[model samples]
Target: MASYKYDIASGAEAFTFNSVMRACTKEVAALSWCMQHGLIAAKAVCSRCAPPPFMRRKGMHWRCSRSSCRVERSVRMNSFVERSTAPISKLVMVIFFWASGTHVTEAAQHAEVGGDGNVVEIDATSMTKKQKYNRGKKHADY
Candidate 1:
């Protein structure tokens, strides 16, 4: 028997790679989805306050609602998105492809070959024209 560090499914999201990828198609959607997955921080804190506390959002960015200390916080503060330059949709699509049992190299290839890298298109085709995706393990070249 082998020991595993993680389960096949994270929670209620059974076989949810497709759904998660779909959810991250937009900026706001990506933020919310990442927050739900614990991949990014959803809330912000006031920096001007003496003790510093959680802040409320005025719009796209968070702001200290207190009239005396109305400091604004960038949406990317302390979040993974702050450092990443890649498009959120591409990241989500790659993650989905990876979670769906596709290798990183294969995922890249799939993305290039299949516009937007949707799972259906990626899964529907194979790298080599000779070896079909679902037919067998032996590659055509081998």
Candidate 2:
């Protein structure tokens, strides 16, 4: 399991959902929250440079500190949100809603996946199944 900054043992009820929602309202705040929650790397190393120079945040990307190397990478690189096309705020809200066991339609509405007229169908059977006896792989070995 991933290490969360908050005490997840207390369950989703104890999670400060409102505070998280507020924090994620802005791009910068969402970035900060993601970093704090280990969703994004706070610091990154440049792969192009030998001995890997530390990368610093420059706008939406991380630039290498070494003047000679000058490598650049997206802030979302190697993170859960890396491939996501949605805004960070929406993604954060969706994740929180899912964690809190909110209904699929409610979560989708909150995340803005579908507008007032659009339909969002959720097939629960398509979701990953629980491991049986914790002995087999979660997915079928095809």
Candidate 3:
């Protein structure tokens, strides 16, 4: 299996291509090359449309090469990041702050994507309202 080096936290570190991509710039190309060369093993398959692919290397890193999948598309094209504008280095820094439990506003401030890259402000109130609505629905069903 292919191997990678990444510093993980004490608790569960969510395994995703984004994390691996955040870890190293070469991880993506390395994993993709590994998959092509049949050097890695598949763990869990994605349940989303087009079924995104996932490869695990000792549970420390992950890669998704499903080019036609939504997750890849979301990471590559959507979200607050542009598809080709921001540098991966800056994105990794943003991910680091996010992993450190910094709030979106604070992270956005640190990202500095507003001036050069398109930075979307996350509305905390909207998220709270959505959570409240979900809770109300669950209670009503009971």
Candidate 4:
């Protein structure tokens, strides 16, 4: 598997939609990409065991390496997408769209917002800004 380093400083100008799509075409690839981008942790320690066993990748979850302690932890734990149920690919696309300043509706469409009975609700209230300290147009007397 190839490795990828996504520099946020470079911005969207460094990557095209096709490139991002190709990089995250598979679940493993997407996970790897997220790891490279620091969006996910590559290693985890099992909290259930004393002396903390190292966790190994077991499908979508991490399993404790100790034979006696078979504890499991989500790969997304403490990551940027921890609460998100969306597929890694879709999430990556959404991130790309957001970083590129694409319109919310268009970004949602491109990212295929929801799937398999999953619902994605977006709050755009923060997207609009209020004039700070009433700095914009002032009210005039009639």
Runs in model 3 lying further than 4 Å from the true structure: 1-86, 115-142
Model 4 scores a TM of: 0.63
Q: Which candidate should be chosen as best, given TM-score against the real structure?
A: 2
Residue lDDT tens for model 2, 27-80: 888888888778889999999988887899997899999998888899989999
* lDDT value, residue 21 of candidate 2: 71
TM-score of each: 0.55, 0.65, 0.23, 0.63
Comparison by lDDT, 1 against 4, better one: 4
TM-score of candidate 2 on Cα atoms, chains taken together:
0.65
The C-alpha stretches of model 4 lying farther than 4 A from their native spots are 1-16, 104-109, 112-142
- RMSD to the true structure for each prediction, in A, is 14.8, 11.5, 13.9, 11.4
lDDT of each: 0.67, 0.80, 0.47, 0.80
Clashing pairs in 4: none
Model 3, 24-100: lDDT tens digits are: 35545543433443333324445574534563243223335455552422223222434546544465555567667
Error in Å for residue 116 of model 2: 9.5
Superposed Cα deviation of residue 28, candidate 2 (Å): 1.4
lDDT of 4 by residue, 73-120 (tens): 889899888999988877888788888799988776666658668787
